[model samples]
Target: MTPVNPESSTLYVQSLATGVQVLRAFNTQRASMSLPEIASAVGISKSAAQRFAFTLEALGMLKKDSQSKRYSLSSANLESGYQYLQCHPLLERANPYLLDLNQRTGETVNLAEPADDCMVYIGRFSSLARLIAHVPIGQRIPMFCASTGRAYLSSLSDDAAREILERSDRVRYTPQTVTDVDALLTLVQQAREEGFACCHDQFYRGDLALAVPIWDAAGNAVAGLNLSVSSTSFTVKRAINKFVPLMLETARLISTTPPNPTALRPFRTEPRGPKEAG
Candidate 1:
């Protein structure tokens, strides 16, 4: 009798997984990829990459350039994310409050949920004053340095937060990023004590962000709400003093809304392994 390979279980569709991996290989760093590049990025053979690329192109999920022979994500790739945001219960409840904060402060307001060691931006309202070039919905920022990340971390038990911090890559994104685990733990502890987190030019230079965690009805932290203002506009002390109370109020108001049991339960305080690409 032949032994069954557990990794090739009948319930798991390896081909579908590989096809998704091929699409994920194209990201902000590599917006367009050749067949060889796709194969190398996805750890698949060139022929398999070609087959998956062809299938994805046929499905309207990828577009192939005739001249360059490189594949890029199509408009169809956005449909899933759009559908998710449109239907997400948390975003539905939080939007009004987030918009209010944005209008009041005239700063960029964002809502992020934890994905392993990174915070994924799910909601954003641009500041009328000036828009930051990089932040878009679906962007991921490191949990070790971002204000939203720290706000979420502050909701977790110290041990769990430490585990996450220790597992993070801990590279300095900017000179201001606190990469030491002990120092980061101190910051999380301070955030826990203060009921909010603040970052000054940590993730991006001249970007100052302040954040507070959003909790579910069950007292689990499900997400974070943050407001970002440029250093050119306000000093850190002034920004904190001006925005912290208002942000706390906004986050508190949003937290009161009962979250979808199934949609939100996964984001509670437990540490996660590295997130998988969709």
Candidate 2:
């Protein structure tokens, strides 16, 4: 991740920031948005939004519908993410293991990285089960509530983890979501000691997940690997006992894989979107 000095603002480009914000306004929920809606969502004037939209459309990153006069992301927009995954050595090495784990458990598996106060899903393998949650890649979940986030936090120093949790929005997503700072700190400490983290219905009701942090050659927690199952299919205890070993093994395998000769840059922090269950 590129380090930023918050005190320095001269290097920041406001136009570029606004352009990126305009692009992020398009999502599964808001697949297409009119210029007015975009302006409101991005907190910009309609003329500025129109300029951003026009520039994006001209660049082939967005397309405007003639009938509704709304703009939507185009296939070209996916190129950036495609290039990211293609160059990420960790995801490249972990793909086969994630596939194997998915087949063995018949459950969803996720590869995620901590970004700011959330964990973003960068890679995922879907379960064959008929009743699984639809968690698309690029979905973000709060660090305090997600198993993957907790696992990554566990690998950090207590003070670092506490700082992140303090900055988190902490909006209660479910009854199980832990908002208390002290309680969450305890969970992080426990995960650090146990080498894994488990969350039951915290991010979403009826969803259960287990995760372990993936370390890099330098011993930094580069990513987190998660196994997600439905509460109806297995108890939390049962899921942890059955999958924790596999998760740890997969994390170790990813950690030991050498970095790509042409290293990939880490993902940028974008505008926050709706949270999804991991």
Q: Score candidate 1 by TM-score against the native.
A: 0.87
* Clash tally for model 2: 0
The list of candidate 1 runs beyond 4 A from truth reads 1-10, 257-278
Q: Look at candidate 2 and tell me the lDDT of residue 131.
A: 40
- Clashing pairs in model 2, backbone N/Cα/C closer than 3 A: none
TM of each candidate vs. truth = 0.87, 0.85
- lDDT of candidate 1 over 94-115, digit per residue (tens): 9999999999888899999999
> What lDDT would each prediction earn against the true structure?
0.83, 0.81
Q: Find the candidate with the highest lDDT and give its number.
A: 1
| Model 2 RMSD, rounded to 1 decimal | 8.0
Angstrom error at residue 163, model 1: 1.0
